[model samples]
Target: MNFFKKLFGKKTGSSNGANQGRANFSGVYSTEHFNERYNEFSLEKDMLDGCLKMIEGYFIDNQIERIIEGPVNHPANLDQVDQSGFGFVLYCQAFELSEGEATMFLAFAFSDYLITKYGFKLYKDQKPDHPLRGMTLKYDKDGVVLSLYPFEYTVKVLKGNETFSALEEKLKANLKELPKVDELLKNFGIGGDK
Candidate 1:
């Protein structure tokens, strides 16, 4: 619809630069290679939306509050991270998921939501000389970019031996403040073009 038109209207950033990795070109961020990757991502739009809906339904079914109460077009900020929020952790623990399962699922759902709704695109750095070698990167045309796993440090909150109340206390009292998503990218030498 109109959204797709606006999103794909003009590709910018370091997309067409030769120094960028050549393979797996998604038209949103790169152009040297074929845009098959972009095509795949475009085609998966429905699946991503469906997954969001499924998560919403699961929460409703369990009588927990909806993580996303409205349209998914919110700003992509760390303070607004829904998947790994307190309610989400409770849901995961309620289902008796292991720490690995909870973290992976939270990360995937968070990534999917960001891509489908927030205009972010995925890029993997495969070049040997790149500092972000082998990292899955995410960015928007507005120059917000970062490692895909921004919650890497936050996941340590999920110690397998802790009780839910104890985990909550640790998360609230012990964990230091998380950096903003763009700040996190800066730490990895990624963004700051603003």
Candidate 2:
């Protein structure tokens, strides 16, 4: 409880590239970074829950080993995103279906496999404790857009022209480096944040 008090005591700050998002100093920001401020609570509960369930099912069926949840708190950005580094920092409850038949959701932040400043070294335990890169995925009638929240360290390195092909290539590279989802299913078996 004391640890929670200390952590919730102060306000954390972050920035967007072209504009600045707002944050309240109150511990109400205790959820994921973009969750509370982004009005994630307004999403239709049943549909959002269904989508989340479907996404997880899709991962299980397709053998993709990616984090399927949002950040537990506000997170910073990572400089060198290696193979295992995960960055979609979003709120799980953040989702919507537009009148135009589009969808949007805040993504989760942080990764379990974050290395120290030296990317050469590896973390001993695969724990999702580190606060790293974060962004939101908006699904419109046209397509999906990954809006990365700009941080001093991450935006410059991660945002390279921000084209469709570039985004595809980066995602491909990241997925290729991850462990096989089937293998993780056999081993980790949803053993709390693999």
Candidate 3:
């Protein structure tokens, strides 16, 4: 009788294992990976809307002369291009005043805008940790230029008639007056400085 009972128990256990099979494997896999995928899906729409709204707001507040939507005409070599995935570009005058200073100012403004607007967390792995790792900034006798790609971000400063050296000097001299500039930008809601 005991042998029969034992044999029946063994049979039941094997049957259970066979029934479970791949069905049990489902819960064992992680759900965390799905979080990122879902988050990215949701963020795509949100980011695009946010970018358009921000651009419109900038134009209205700053009273900029012209504000064009979508891909507009730009000089091939003049302005910087930041290719954040949401389809946006920040076009401005490069060194309208030095190449180095214009480059520096653009970097600062872009970085500030990213952090404030998108809640982009900066990684502390580097001295100035932002998603902007491996970014490039270059200056020539003509002017300063930079380009960012891959749905990350970019800033293009257009060069006018000013020489790169003159623009650099102007940026350096204006450093002390940045606070006032900051206040002006704040008024325009550029970086949320207010």
Candidate 4:
């Protein structure tokens, strides 16, 4: 038998044919669906890691106290993208912006890094009025807050959410747990003091 045919031909319920059953069910999920889900998951993971690295670099570089507590919250389905073939809309929030300068610099640095590193085009030039291009700094009864929206449509960092701080802290404490994120940070010159 030809190699192709032998490899995919009849299964004889043997040790080597264990995957044959899975092959039979492959048609149950279309290849496109599989690819979409996989891609969405990958994008979300990358985005989360990217955010962490950006914050870490900002903290280290500026000598600011690290407020990140845990892994970013995973992307969730949103109404706008629910039926748009997009899998999910992820949101992250960082807080305790008492260090205003560092927070502003970090947000801009992260935006620049995203554009240069990932080719994520900003909707417009960085300006206060630029819809997807500006940083918002606010002061409330509690403290200062900075909200950063890096991606035009998919990702955002909010303020005033309690869970956000907790998540950030968890991420910082468990930095070693996410190897892939660490690799990305190292590649981007984030983890090192330089």
Off by over 4 Å in 3: 1-43, 67-194
Q: Which number leads on TM-score?
A: 1
For residue 48, give model 1's deviation from the true position in Å.
Answer: 4.8
lDDT per residue (tens digit) for residues 100-147 in model 2: 111122121121111111121111211222233222222111111122
* Each model's Cα RMSD: 13.7, 19.3, 26.5, 20.7
TM-score per model over all chains: 0.37, 0.21, 0.22, 0.21
lDDT per model vs. reference: 0.38, 0.26, 0.28, 0.30
Q: Across residues 1-194, which tens digit of lDDT does each residue of candidate 1 receive?
A: 00011111123447567322112222123344323223222325665565455456555555654334554322222113333345445655677866555554444455554566444455444441234222232443333222333234225324432222232232222113323446544554666963
**lDDT, candidate 1, residue 132?**
21
* Candidate with better TM-score, 3 vs 4: 3
Which 10-residue span in candidate 3 carries the lowest summed lDDT? 1-10
Per residue, candidate 4 scores C-alpha lDDT tens digits across 98-182 of 3333233334434444334323333322333345334322111111111224322222332322222332343233322322433
TM-score of 2: 0.21
The parts of candidate 2 lying over 4 Å away from their true place are 1-41, 67-194
Q: 149, model 4: CA deviation in Å?
A: 2.5
The Cα error of candidate 2 at residue 107, in Å, is 6.2
Over the full model, what C-alpha lDDT does candidate 3 score relative to the true structure? 0.28
What tens digits encode model 3's per-residue C-alpha lDDT throughout 1-194? 00000000113225555532111111111234322322221123454444445444434444443323432212111122222222222322321424333344334344333334323322221221244333322111111111121112232232333322232343333322222324434554657745
Clashing pairs in 3: 80-156, 80-157, 82-154, 85-151, 94-158, 98-167, 98-168
Candidate 1, superposed: residue stretches over 4 Å from native: 1-54, 71-97, 124-135, 140-194
